[model samples]
Target: MFPDHTSTHADTAIAPGDDTEHHEGNPRPRAMTSTAEIDSTISHPGSVRINVKGAFIVDSTEQPATPANGNSTVNGSYHEGKDIRLPNHTAVVSHIAVDIGGSLAKLVYFSREAHSTEPGGRLNFHSFETDRIDDCIDFMRHLKDNQLALNGSKPKDLCIMATGGGAFKYHDKIKKALGVDVLREDEMACLIIGLDFFITEIPREVFTYSETEPMQFVEPQADIYPYMLVNIGSGVSILKVSGPKKYERVGGTSLGGGTLWGLLSLLTPANSFDDMLEMAAQGDNAKVDMLVGDIYGTDYNKIGLKSTAIASSFGKVFRMKREAEDEAEDNANVAQDHPQLDQKVHASSNNATSSSQPRGLNDMSSRFSASDVSRSLLYAISNNIGQIAYLHSHIHDLSHIYFGGSFIRGHPQTMNTLSYAIKFWSKGQKQAYFLRHEGYLGAVGAFLNRQPQNWGRRGSFEGDGAALEDRLRARTSEH
Candidate 1:
């Protein structure tokens, strides 16, 4: 629901004045080059948020070189430091993290005021977005050319943090196209890692309701210890996150963003997922939705079921509307001319304008309005998911619900609907915790893969980084 993604306010901190030193030893400072000379058609700093499925942000002010240039990689590069000290080195890394979904590929990179060799400076992160995978590949190649074309900037070791179904299938193409290695991750694991980080790190990124204005959720002192993680992606995947590296595949279902997107795509004239939601906002489900009265012709008195309940799924409303728009034109003209003064008379006739579906599902191509379809779609998916999640929480006897993935990028109505559903279902016992950087969970994992908890106890995860550090030493002969 949080709409104003003002760059003025991101969840990052440099501990003001904490930055002072560069790497203990490194090469001569090179002049920054003009990316303009390289190619001018690429977008820098990718996506601020992932789509409906659990994905990561790929928008950033960073770019990779083109393929023809030879060295410039599209995904970005990676590097290691001579010593595992305070400041880290990653300038050589091209693309730090990435996730490829059915229709989109996300790229994330870190931005440092000084080189990664520098001490403590904030890493301004961003991502890239594209409907087609080829576009992303071209982008990485462009970035490589631009970086190499720089006066002194050299290519760095880049690790491709990839997830989703395409990760395994597209691994090689990603590697060859970007000229980098893909660090494959468990789709669910990435979700958990992302959940843990969001719960533990950023304050105010999450908000829970109270008697007063919603409190900007502060990270509980030990929030990540254990929680039930529900990743609402292309589909839903639930996990019981025990710790950073310890989580279990708890439960999930087919009812997910894909379901909503798919149904709307076929049933409504809606184009994008956002468009579907816009129309649904004004659409009365009574038109298409099956009602209880249509079944028993009365309330299920024994169970206290309302007479107007949804008895059967997809049982009614095939035409999805009572009357077509073209037929209603005559009535509108007569009503406009009369300008009827009787309020009661107005109620006598079923006003077609107030109660009518679009002429037909084919009308989707008619036009795209700044519609509320996005909001409606969000509610249905979130509400259903929330109810299902609440059921799981109740079944497992879990308390905390950590919602992670690309789909929950601060969609307010979705969050509100979900939170309310959880409250209604749990009677206010359980709460749904969300993260700000919803999609980059896997990329962050790939970034933190070097941590001891990950890459096994010996910690080979940081090898790419470490090897690069050693190479730097051999060349510059610096400490």
Candidate 2:
């Protein structure tokens, strides 16, 4: 849960300094031009005018172009060398949208081009920890100020579209900080809309991950209906999406990303979620988890369970602790009965090197390394989510299941576990899909809410979508 009111003292700004260099030509005076003049200008090759709401002006003879590196150079300044590419021409920042979840706040905004043929500008993505709401507000304030300086006047329609629980919780703070109206949209609806845009419009946005072939792109299907969306955030929500803006939250679980995070915070030395993930990556879950082989001495072929399959998460640790406690108790009894022998043993143990001495129950980290604990907990959470998601898909008879939300973070182990769960549960009849920008779905959906409902199918908006797809594909190929 988020606090109703933000703290009086703002958190330190986490954004780095602007290091992007800028080059600008002489500013051209603004003069209104007739539609005929705009038509005639278009007739001439390489000449275009800035068209704003039927008003046209020749800003430059040549159209401004985005750099080949997919970095936007807007208003004489680059986007701090970020990979974000906006429309060719510079425009005002009219609107911003945010999806503030329990853990993270994702933001999406657009800089409309003043002199471009495209209808929609490129979307920029940014996020911050929920605890750092002040920092996020600062970033938004900077963006609004920058736009005000460029256009010399604020757009009357400027507003912040927000979703998630934090929208209502942080509404007053955001409005007071930025002096902009906050519009709250339904959280689930925004997620579906955002996902629909990416899967339908953006090329290579959706993909499948596996151990054999990681990040294999899945082309947008012609009939992408009735699919299951398992959004793993602080909690998990499984929805059955039948069409655009048509979805229902059928099932969910509390054992989600938050579960792993809370457990790791108490059990491991990981200071952050990424740190826990990194620790888990190097860990051997077999050390702390009970496997099928441990229980059966071989694979449970009757039920098709493999030898390496996890029998119980942290199951080995429980048994190990009990055995250690019983041994310690036995040692205490022997020491009470045979004091001389116990003294010799104690002296020998004290004389031995620290590495040679057995780790006690108090030193759980030494007995069961933090890495192994992290790995086991990660598997436990991922496996539980995957199984529940699969069950929902099965109940609805939906074959295509997509996992989204901040929890995945495109981490291989997380994806692999989820994918493997679906495969194991459905006997390879179902597959799990992922997204490149999985975490920003709600933010994007809220951004798109500013546009007309049918914008995706409109001619100009379709053209913009194609352009964005091309840009994203180009960036992907370069990497």
Candidate 3:
């Protein structure tokens, strides 16, 4: 069983029948004897070592093969291993931690070797849309049933850690579906924990993104304190972190991924979030947005505003619509005033309209390109988030800002806009950082919550292997 705690930061107590022994001056419990030699060098992101039959098995395989069930793959594969044991030698055959948001439900779980009681296994990451909650449940059920069949017995414990708003919203659904108590962790706490682990323990985890240089990995800072974490999901949350568990909700905005998604869904024919992003990638926001040049006919040098800078998102559409309406009205008046000339005027109008139609809001497909609309909204949202994040950082005087959440999805335009905003507002003083596994922060944090504190420090396994093995044996004796 996992450590029992009253709260996320509360002191944890070892569960009954646990093999670990507490040591004075050491936060993590140690095993009586070392049964395995842990290695920290793993060629994977967020890789951690766990004792497995006195051996360490690192998952070095590429992306897992997609399931035939048509479930989308995010980071980790589901069909990598059949029988994976939960860490810490508990009787829990299926262990999973989820971060369910307004849009996406991210999952982090361990998949171990088949029919093996080994602790070492692959840590897999997956995500599903919140609207499609059944798919996520089905995937979890698949993992549970597969483990049951391979182990030939029902698990004594089924551990499920959850976070985010959907953790409570979908708590009963998950518990009733999986038949296990859903352990809820604080969303903000999990986000900080997950982010701290990645920045400190995982190499090449944090990087800077910009249009000039797409991604440049940043080395872990020697002392990473007084930084800001801007998590952009359905909404935005800006946090000021002073230490590992010390943070405060500084500022945020409701204009985030949901705003873009909602606007795009209504304005365009995009079927999914990814589709909208694809449309954005192929779009030119200038076509839909009103720029400084559109307003001033040139850059406002006195105010330092570039001509190409966006003055208003979708601002030109209004004027274009008015012009189109006026032309249509005038044409109708002319046709009414002159009966014989009506056919000639109508034919000329048809030819002129066919030759060059004014870009307006009247025609859905012709005037407003889905790509242009998608790109404009994407820029609007990203720019707003970036500016707000910079403001929080400035007020708090935090130089380092890390951006996380599913909204990013490592999209080039989104990252570029965010990075540019930070640079422009801060005059190149403050930097915006991004994570490789940005979307799974909460999920990974929940996953780590099940393990001992500092269990995955520096990507090396530090625990009592003898105690783990003994616990594994004791659990097997019952079945």
Counting clashing residue pairs in each candidate, in order, gives 63, 0, 2
Against the true structure, whose lDDT is highest?
3
Q: TM-score of predicted model 2? A: 0.71
Model 3 scores a TM of: 0.73
Cα TM-score per model: 0.57, 0.71, 0.73
**How close to the true structure is residue 59 of candidate 3, measured as C-alpha lDDT?**
29
Residue-wise C-alpha lDDT for candidate 1, range 65-144, written one tens digit per residue = 11121222343321111101112332223335566665335455444333444432222233333345666666556555
lDDT of each: 0.48, 0.67, 0.68
Model 2 misplacement above 4 A:
1-93, 111-121, 148-157, 330-359, 451-479
Off by over 4 Å in 1: 1-95, 114-131, 145-153, 209-215, 267-271, 274-377, 450-479
After TM-score superposition, the amount by which residue 324's alpha carbon in candidate 2 deviates from its true location, in angstroms, is 2.0
Question: Which candidate leads in TM-score?
Answer: 3
lDDT score for residue 337 of model 1: 66
Per-residue error for 84 in candidate 1, Å, reads 22
Clashing pairs in 3: 31-464, 84-112
Better of 2 and 3 by TM-score: 3
